[model samples]
Target: MEKVIEMKGITKVFPGTIANEDVDFDLLKGETHVLLGENGAGKTTLMNILYGLYQPEKGEVYVNGQLAKITNPNDAIKLGIGMVHQHFMLVNNFTVAENIVLGREPKKGLKIDINKAIKDVEEISKKYGFSIDPKAVIENISVGQQQKVEILKALYRGAQILILDEPTAVLTPQEIDELAVIIENLKKEGKSVILITHKLKEVMKMSNRVTIIRRGKVTGIVKTSETNIDQLAELMVGRKVNLVVDKEQAKLGKEILRVENLVAKDSRGLNVVDGVDITVNAGEIVGIAGVDGNGQSEFIEAITGLRKPESGKVVLSGKDIYGKSTREIIDSGLGHIPEDRHKRGLILKYSLFENGILGLQHKKPFSKGIVMDYKAIRKHCKKLIEEFDVRTPSDEVNASALSGGNQQKFIAAREISKDPELLIASQPTRGVDVGAIEYIHKRLVQERDNGKAVLLVSLELDEIMALSDRIAVMYDGKVVDILDRKDATEQKLGILMAGGSLSEAKREVKDVE
Candidate 1:
């Protein structure tokens, strides 16, 4: 195999951290090579150096055996290197064609040829089996379609080497499989890919070779054929990692939360959550399983008081709390680990100590007659940092200073510390690494064992299956079926999630246990 890209002794440093230190990485021609690491482990830093978004303080970069100086994205693009960021950088209001052809627009004399741009986008999308509509607005499309547009944008720029940073982080399982096909097609067309992700399963399924990095340095490089998820996880985290979530059977208790005829609307004023009824009992995890945008977010927001329900009874511990304010709801025994950690879980600009007391800022110990007890707040923050293994330099630092996984851990720690009667954890481990996922799962199960009701909402079916005592399948804003853990399989859940009738799903699978 020919080495198409190589970085030797690459070192990058920030004010307070060595982002990458003496990292040597290489990519072979026409191969899917994964750069695997935990959050803030310098995986993105190294890739940024390669993409010309950041320059290495020291080291050499070689493209096709020739020394190259890529000081900007334009330079990298000209050198046949294109990168699709984790967050899709498309203008939401723009059409897919417009986004793809923004920088290099095809023009007929003086004006941009819109039709030609659309045609070009369509051609590339078809060639790569992306199935994207060129004329569709980015905001109106599914997250998966928007991702394909990002890929199309890179491909349209004549890229021979593509870097996808956490591409599957926001995708559904079906979309993930579709992306695998897209990658295979790209490889068949002689294009190389550098995949930056922490997902061990995807790395195993998609990569030809895997390079494991931990704490700013390469730990091991191995052929995918010879490596397993366990080995890769140990390499990434520098310890023996527990892949399976260990938990005993649930000991059900009285209902902690009950939602009857829950109706909620999206920003557009159209009902997204339509008459959904659900309940979570103490000492059990009732996981809501569905594809994203299938009313899960609205349903959670409705119950959490982030959004008011149109018509529903949200009973918390037998008390109807639907119309209560968010703070009142929290005070009335609810802990929410919101779906968007940055937006709802923590204030990015606030110090970790301040963020630690976010939902509980009005409570005792931390609050005394409207004057905050900074001493107590700091004490609590430090405790959470130690307890949750939040890897931060200090409590005085801003929440944004921490890594994604650390930030998530901090939020979970703060929420769990509240010891609320009903805990609503929405997409708790969405973008976190496997190690953090393990910790978060254990914490959720611990809460259950400690006689707390946990309502888990996640798009990852496997996660729901592993963690839930019972699975509630939601489709088109309704609970299609709630099955016991013993009766729930991925296949059955898939059918229910796709709006299959409960009877049809029941007929497809034999009862277990």
Candidate 2:
């Protein structure tokens, strides 16, 4: 096989971190090559050097067996290399065709040929079996469709080599399956792909060859057929990793949270969450399973007091806490791990110690009579760092300085340590590595065992099946059905997620209550 990309002796460094050190990576033609690593392990840094977003301090890049100097993204595109970032960079207000043909568009004399651009985009999408409306606005489409637009944008740019970073991070399971097929189609067209992700299951399902990197150096490169999940996990983390989540059966207790006839509107002033009811008991985990944008966010926000419910009784330990101030709700025994960590969970610019006591800043030990207590705050932050295994050099460092997993761990430690009666963890392990996922899962289960109510909301059905004592399926802003752990399967969940009737979904599960 011909080598499409060869990065030799790559070394990239930041002010306080050695991102990549003497990393050698290569991708063969017409193959899906995976780059596996822990968060901040220099996987993205290495790929940025290849994509010309960042220049390595020392390295040599070869494209199609020839030396290449790619100092900018334009240079990379000219070399038939296109990258789809983890966060889609499309302008939300622009049409799909317009976004795809932004820099390189067909011209008709003095003006851009809009029709030509749309036709070109439609043709590429059709060729790859992508179901995307070329004229639809980016924000108007579903997240899965938006992802397809990103892929279409890459294909329209005449790319022979594509780099996808964490492509399945925000996608539903069905969308992930579709993306796998799309990658296969791209492979059939003889395009080389380099996938950078920490998901071992995806690596096994998609890659032809797998490269494991740990702390900025390549650990091992092996054929996908020869490596199992255990081997890949060990190689990536530099230790033995237990993949399965170990926990005992739940011992149910009294109800900690109850919601009745909850209603909420989305940003567009539409009723996204309508007539929903849920209950979570002490010593139990109630997981909300649904596709993204199915009113899960609004439901969580209403419960946490981030958004007020239109009409509902949000009873926290027998107290109606609906429409209460966020602080009031928190003081009423609620701990929230919000869906958007950067936006909702942490102040990125603040130090770790500052963010550690964010919601608790007004309370005792952290603040005394409105005077900030730095000594006590620092002590608590240091304890959380050690107890939660947050990998950071010092508590003075900004929260943004840490990796995604570490930031999440910090937030989890902060919320869990407060020992609230009810804990709401939303997408707790999204975009984290397998090791971090394991740690977070154990903590959630621990909270349950300690007689705290845990409300888990996630798009990953497997996660729901593994963690939830009772599973609530949501569709179109309503709780379609609630099932016991034994009655919930991926197939039945998928049917309910797609808005199928409860009876139809229950028919698929033999022992349903």
Choose the strongest candidate by TM-score: 1
CA lDDT of each prediction against the hidden true structure: 0.92, 0.91
Compared with the true structure, model 1 gives a TM-score of: 0.96
In the range 447-503, model 2's lDDT, one tens digit per residue, is: 999999999999888789989999999999999999999877887888889999768
Candidate 1, 1-513: lDDT as tens digits: 899999999999876788899999999999999999988898888988999999989999999999999999999999999999876799999999999999899999999999999989878988998887889999989888898998989999999999999899888899999999999999999999999999999999999999999989999999999989999999999999998999998999999998999899987888899999888999999999998889998899888888988997889997879988999899889999998888888899999999999988888999999799999999999999999888777899999878777788999999999999999999999778999999999999999999999999998888999999999988898998999999888888999999998787777765542
Candidate 2: which stretches are off by over 4 Å? 509-513
lDDT of 1: 0.92
Note the clash tally of each candidate: 0, 0
For candidate 2, list the clashing residue pairs, or say none: none
Off by over 4 Å in 1: 510-513
Question: RMSD to native for every prediction?
Answer: 1.9, 2.2
Question: For every model shown, what is its TM-score relative to the native structure?
Answer: 0.96, 0.95
